[model samples]
Target: MRGIVLNATLAAVKFAGGVFGNTYALIADGAESLIDILSSLLVWAGFRVAARPPDANHPFGHGKAEPLAALAVAVFIFAIAGWIAWSAIREILTPHQGPHWATLPLLAGVVAVKLWFSRRMTRASEEAGSTGLQVEALHHYSDAITSAAAFVGIGIAVWGGPGYETADDWAALLACAVILFNGVLMFNRALADVMDTAVSPEFESEVRTVALGVPGVAALDKCRVRKSGLSHLVDIQVRVDGELSVRAGHDIAHAVKDALLASAPHAISDVSVHIEPIK
Candidate 1:
């Protein structure tokens, strides 16, 4: 919420400054900030939906909404990158007067804010285990880089040699490439979550250790883990004595689940344990 508000305000400031100062780089940076606002909104909405409990229609809960929103953010970033690149090319072909001197200081301020925001967001994302926030933090880092480029663009336009009127355009073009690269990375990460990639090796090991500690009659067979937003669901198979009664096996399964939930580091949504006869 705070991020959305701050980015929106910055977007307005940069766009207005760009028009008055005749700086294409500032305009492009402002457009990126506008998209940043949109991305933050999508992330907030995704988390809200993800936190909802399981419903009759969706048994696994709405946790997938997080990755879906992350994908949306990546798309927005791609669109902005393409637009910036196209505009930069046009500015390069038809040279224009350098930016007004006032735009330089304004863009410098933007770069500073983005740098601070990037660090703050990175910490928050790590603590929350939020993929969307992680992507947004990287986006902010990219924004800081591009805003620095914008600052240089304005500086070149206002103070460079007579033939360097297009320096700002070159900077904008570089910013566009950075945005595109970051967008692709963020997209791949979000897509992996959507595809139900396996949990981290450490998390899996932790679960296995907890499962083994439970008082069971035999060996463990298989373990599978799937992520659903901030939480995960687990499925395991265990082998017990062939002569054990069904109720006894059922009780053992519940005990394994309890032990795992009590010891696992992450929030586990559910656990399914399958009992097999010890061969």
Candidate 2:
């Protein structure tokens, strides 16, 4: 919500500054900010859907929505990158006057604002362990990168005068490459999550250790952990004495599940335990 509002306001301010101040780089930055508003809206909707509980139609819940949203964001970034690149190239080829001196301060302020928002989103992403939020943070950082580039490019144009008018356009072109690179990274990450990639070795090890600590569990035969949005789903096989009664084995399985859930309430959303005979 905050992101949407901020992006919209910045987009308007940047567009106005770019048009009146005669900086194509500022215009490109504004276009990126406009895209950010759309991306934030998509992320917001995805999160809402992802938070929905499981239903008869969907047994695994709606967690996939989060990654789907991230994927959409990546697509938007690619489109915007292409648009900015085309615009920058056209501006570079055309002869134009240097940007107004006032636009330099505007670019500087934009860089500061984007950096602040990037930090805030980074903290939120870490705490929530959300792919969508992480993408949002990257968007802010990318915006800051573009804004900083524009600041320097405009400074060079205004300082050197006349022949340097194309410097800001070159900077905008560079920003497009950076945006496209980030888009690829975000797409790959989101696709991995959608494909149900295995959790990290260290995280799986932690889960295995917790399961082993439960009483009656002799050893673990297998432990598989996969991420679903902000949480993890675990499947594990634990070896037990063959002599133990069926009821005892069931109890042990339940105990293991309980311990894992208790250890990381926010992380582990569900667990399935398979009890195996030691023979």
TM-score of 2: 0.98
Q: For residues 83-197, what per-residue lDDT tens digits would candidate 2 score against the true structure?
A: 9899999999899989999998888888899999999998998898888988988888889998988888899999999799989998888988898888888888888889998
Q: Per-residue CA lDDT of candidate 1, range 87-126, in tens?
A: 8999999957878888888888888898899889989888
| lDDT winner | 2
Note each model's CA RMSD in angstroms. Answer: 1.5, 1.0
- What is each predicted model's overall lDDT from 0 to 1? 0.87, 0.91
Measured by TM-score, how close is model 1 to the native structure? 0.95
Candidate 2, overall lDDT?
0.91
